[model samples]
Target: MYVAVKGGEKAIDNAHAWLAEERRGDTDVDELSIAQIREQLSLAVNRVMAEGSLYDPDLAALAIKQARGDLIEAIFLIRAYRTTLPRFGYSNPVDTGTMRCDRRISATFKDAPGGQVLGPTFDYTHRLLDFKLAADGDAPHAPVAAPRQEDTPHITEFLKGEDIIQDEVFSDDTPGDLTREPMAFPSNRPLRLQSLTRGDEGFVLGMAYSTQRGYARNHAFVGELRIGKVSVEMDIPELGFAIDIGEVELTECETVNQFQGSKTEPPQFTRGYGLVFGQSERKSIAMALVDRALRWEELGEDNLGAPAQDEEFVLSHADNIQATGFLEHIKLPHYVDFLSELELVRKLRREAEARMAPKEAAE
Candidate 1:
C-alpha cells in the first residue's frame, strides 16, 4: 500500500554542491564582499534589519551575502541567528523627541518650527535614466545648508495643544511579543503595531492601498515623517542610572486621519503611527494608513469588513517567511497522500459501477 524512496541523502548533498557553485557564478569575477553590501546596498541591509528585528548592519549584510542577495531569505537567516544569541536585558524605549534628525518633513504644515529638510529623497527626481550612471556611477554632490540645532517638535503636538487631535493615552502595560508566544485573536494596538513593523513591506502596502480605494477608507494626511538616529539606553541595577547603549537610525511617521465624533467624545482628528528601522518612508506611510484602518473599532468608527480592518487576517498572513514556508512546502513529497486519494476514488468508482450494472440489466 505504500513505498518509501531511499538515497535522498546523496541527492541532497549533490544538490547543495550544485547550489554553492551557482551562488558563486563565474569564479574569475571577484565575489561580493559583506562590506560592499553594507555600504553600497545599504537599503537592502536596512530592510533585512527592519524585518529581521535585529539592528546589526554587519550581520544583516553578511546574511544578505550568504543568501545570495535574496532579501527575504536574508531576513530569515538573521531571525534564525538572533534566537541563538543570549538575551542580556531589554533597553528602555528610545526617545524620538530627542532624535538627531537628518530628514524631517511635515505635510500638514508648509513651514513649521524646523523647516522641511529633504535629505537624500527621490521625490523630486525625474524618471530619467542617466547613461553616465551605467558607465562610472559617480555623481556630483549638491551643497546643503547647516543642520538645525533646535529639536523639532512633532507636528501632532501642535494640534494636540488646541485639542484638535485626539490625545494618545499613556500606558505602562508591557506589550506581548508574538515571537515568544502564539498570536491570539482581537489583538491590541501594541501587538498590531509590532506585527506591522515586521510585516512584509509589499503585503502591508497592498492592504493599505485597499483602505485608500474606498474599502474602509480613512482620509489620511501625512502629519509628519522623520528619519534620524535615536539613543538607546538601558537601566543597570548596579549603576543606579540608565546608560546609553548605542544609537540606531529610525524612521517615524504620523498620519492625521478624518475627524471622529461620538456622544461620549468630541470631534477630533485621529492619528496613525508608524515606526521602522532606517529610512523607509514609503513603508512607514503605508504602515500608518493600515494602522489607522485597524483602529476602526477603537476609534468608534464602523468596521466595513475591509481586509486592512481585519486584525486577525492581516497579522496572521503578514510575515513573508511564514507565508513562503507553508506555500513552498507543497513541493515536498506527497506521494503517500496522493496514493491514498487515488485508492479511495477507484473504490468509489467500482462500487458505483457495480450498482449501475444491476440496474441496467433489470432495465
Candidate 2:
C-alpha cells in the first residue's frame, strides 16, 4: 500500500485532513447520524455487512459514514477491524424454516403455501423520482396486521412430496470455514456457499446473468425467496445444549433447476440454494444461480466451460476485499516495472529497424 511520493508522512497527513473536509462537505448542513444510515440507507448497510462478513449493523453504518458512502471502502474497514476481535466460538447453523419472514415470494407457483407476502419492496412502484422526498417528508406509516400463525412450508417440500425434485440430505459433518482454513480447490458445497454468500454482488450478478445467456444454462425457477429474522445459536459446553445467542436478518433463495437424472438416480428437478445476511434479494438470487452452475459435476451435468463453473476462478475472484486489494495496488507507482518494460520495447524496436535497414539497402 506504499505510494511512491515526495513529502512522505506530513504530506499523507495533510491529504487525510483534506479527505475528512471533503467527506463533511458543507458546514451549513447537519452531519449524518449513524442511526439515519442504519435505518434509511439500510440497503447500503446490508451490502456492507454481506461483503464485509460481519453482522453488526451499527458498525456497518459507522464504517459507511467513515468511508463516506463508499461501500467497498466501508467493507474493507469493517474486515480490517474484525481481524482484531477475539473469536469466542462459532455460532450453530441458523434454521431458515422457522424464520419470522418479513418478505416472501415464489415464481414457480402462483399461490404456494403461506401465500405471497410482498413486504417492503419497490417492485410495483413507478421508477420516476418523487419530489416529495426532497422536501423532507417521510411516508406515513402503513396499517399493520398480526403475523400468520401457520407454519410456512417451503415450495420445495410440495415438489418433494411428488418426488419430482431432489431431496436436501442433511449431513452430520461440520462445514468448513474458508477464513479458518486455507482455501483448497475441489471444495465442498458448504465452503463454496460460504464463498458465494460473501462474494462481490456485482461479480455474482454478472456470473448469474451469463448462465441465462446460454453459457452453461441451468433453467432455474425461483422456488422460494424469503427475507426475515433468524436466530443465531451457539452450543454451550457447560449447559450441554445450544442457546439462541442473537437474531439476524437474512435473505434465503431456493431455485428449482432442471436436472436430467444420472444412471443411479431418477429424472427429477435439482436445487440451488442461497442464504445470505440481510435483505439482499439480488445477491441471494445471483448466489443461487452460481451455486447451481458450480454443481454441474455433482448433478451429472457436463461442464460447459463457463466462468461460474470454474470453482477456483469464482471463489478466488468473488471476494471484493481481495479483488480491490489487487486492483487498487496498481494505483501506486509501478516505476521500475514500467521503466523495464519501456526499455525492452525500445531495444526490440531498434533491433527490428536495424534489420529492416539492411534489407532495404540490399533491395
Candidate 3:
C-alpha cells in the first residue's frame, strides 16, 4: 500500500541527533579539544581552511573536530560561518615582492634572487609510519635561526628584466568576490582564481592530470612556489588611507606555461597563478595547471574540446560540498517516482505477453 509519509521535520531532527552522537563517540572518554586538533592534526585544519576560503586556523580546527574529521564538512562549517561575518574592509594587495617568505622555491632556475628554501616539506620523508606518533608523542624543537627583516624578490622579476616573461599590469581597481556574487560567463582572472582556490582538490588535480595525459599538453614549469604569511591591509575612510588589518598564511604557486605569442605580441612565457589559504602545495600546483588549461581561448590556442578548457564544467564541479551534497541527496526518499516507474514496466510487460499469447493461438 502506498502511504503518504509526513515526518520530514522529525526525520531531520533524528538524523541531526544521530549525527551529534556519532560525532562524540564514547562520551565518557575525553572529548577532542579544538586546540589539541589544531596543534596535532594541523594538516587537516589546513585543508579545511584552504578549501573553506577562510584564514582562521582555530575555527577550521574546531570545525574539523565538530564535523568528526570530515575535511569537506569542516570546510562547509567554516564557509557557513564566514557568511555571517561582517567584513569591515578589504586589504590592499600585499606585494609578494615584499613578502617575508618562510618557504620559497623556483623549479625554472637553480638559483633565483630569493634563494630556494625548502622549509618543512615532506618531499624527502620515508613513507613508513612512526608507531611512536600513535601515542601522541611530543615533537622536538629545532635550532632557532636569527630573526632578520629582509625583503624577498620574486623570481618572475628576473625574467621581467630580460623581457622573457609576459607583462603583468596591476590594476588599482577592486575585484569582485565570487562567493558574494553569482558567477557569470567569461569570468575575470580574480573570480577564476577564487573559484579554483576553493575548488575540490581532487577534481582540480584530476583535470590537471588530464592535461598532462595529452588532453591539452601545455608544458608548465613551476616558475615559483611560496608559502608564508602576509599582512592584510584595508582602507579606512575615516583615516584617509589603508591600514594593516591582520596577517594570513597563504600558499601561492605561479607556473610559467609554454604559450606561443599571439600575432599582436612577441613570444614570451605566460603565467598561470594559484593562491590558496594555507600550506597546500599540491592543490596550488594543480590549480596552476588547470588555470593555464582554462586560458586556451585567451592564448589563441584551439579549444581541442578538452574538459579542462570547458569553464562551465570545471567551475561547476569543482566544489565538493556542492557536488557531494547533490550526489548524496539521492539517498532521500523517492518511493513515489519508483512506484510510477514500476507500474509503467508492469504495463509494458503485460502488453507484450498478451501480444505473444494471441500470436501463438492464431498459429
Candidate 4:
C-alpha cells in the first residue's frame, strides 16, 4: 500500500517560479518581445501555426515565447488556446487555381506555363554559414520583378490534357474533422491529409525518406509546388452569397508517381496531393510522399506493410503532444509498480535457487 504524496501545490508553484526565472535568462540582456519573435523568427511561428492548426501569427509567436522556443510545446499551447474560441462558420475551401502565386516551380517539365518562377526558395543556396549575418550588417535586397497576377496553370493539367495522368473526380462530400471526431480505421484521403498536415515535421520527413530508401517506393516527381495567398470565403445564407473572410499563405504540392494500370483501366500516372498553411515547401513535399504511401488501397497498389503505408500507425503516432505526454509520463513516480515488479523478480530468483539446491545435494 502506498500513501498519496502531498504538497504538490507548493512544489508546482516553486517549479513555475524557477521556470519563469530560467525563461528570462540574464537580467542585463533585453528580453525577447513577441513582436521580435513574430518578425525575426517567422519560420518558427509558421511551423507552430501549421502544426497547431491555427493561422494566427501573433498567438503563435506568443506561444513560442511562452514555450521558450520549443516548437512542439508552442504548438500545444496554440492548440489548447484554439479550443476556447467560439466557431462562427466554416469557410469555403480556397481555390488554389486562382492563387496569387509568389513562387511556382515544376520538376516534370523544364519549361512550364508559369516558367518556373523560383520565388524566395533556398533550393540553389549554398549551405555555408554566413558569418556576416551574426553581425548587424544591412544586406542588399534582391531585385524584384513586377507582380504577376495571371493564374498559373497546374502541371498536372498539362498531363491531363494528354490523358497521361489518372483522373481525380472531385467529391461534394464534407470532409471529417479529426479534431472533433474519433478517428475510425481505414481513414479516407481527406482525413489522412489532415493528419499529415498537422503531424510532426521531422517524423513526416523521416517517413518520406524511408519510402525513397525502397520501403513502398512510389517514384514521385514534383508535379507542381506553388506558394501563395488564397482568399478564404464563407457562405452566408442571410447575404445569399459567400463573402471573403480573409486571405492566408499556403504551400501546395502535387506529386506525380509511376504509372499504374489494370485489366479494366488504362495505364496512367497517379498523384499524391498536399496543401499546408504558410510557406512550408519541405513539409508539403514530405506530406505528398506520405499521402501517396497511405493511398495503397484506393489506388489498387500492394500493401507493402511499410511504416508510411500503415494508416492506423501513421494517424495514431502523428500527434507530437500525445506522444510527448506519454513519453514524459515515465518521469512521474511509479513506486508501487516498481515495488511489485521487484518482489516478483525476487520470488522468481528464490524459486530457482531452491530448485537448484535440491539438484546440487542429490549430485
Where does model 1 exceed 4 Å of error?
A: 1-6, 137-139, 351-363
Give the per-residue lDDT of model 1 (tens digit) for 288-331: 99999998888778779888899999999999889988888777
Q: Each candidate: what lDDT?
A: 0.89, 0.91, 0.85, 0.89
Q: Judged by lDDT against the true structure, how good is candidate 1? A: 0.89
Please give, for residues 143-238, the per-residue lDDT of candidate 2 as tens digits. 788769866778888998888998889877888988889789999899999999999999999999999998888999999999999899999999
Each prediction's TM-score versus the true structure = 0.94, 0.95, 0.91, 0.95
TM-score of 2: 0.95
Angstrom error at residue 11, model 4: 2.5
lDDT digits (tens) for residues 106-174 of candidate 3: 999887765778878887889789788778657778666775478777788888889888877878877
- Judge candidate 2 against the unseen true structure and give its global Cα lDDT, from 0 to 1: 0.91
Clashing pairs in 1: none
Candidate 4 global TM-score: 0.95
lDDT of 3 at 299: 73
**Displacement of the residue 332 alpha carbon in candidate 3, Å:** 1.3
Error (Å) of candidate 4 at residue 342 is: 2.2
Name the weakest run of 10 consecutive residues (lDDT summed) in model 4: 259-268
Tens-place lDDT digits, model 4, residues 88-128 = 87888789999889889999898898789998888889989
Q: State which candidate, 3 or 4, has the greater lDDT.
A: 4
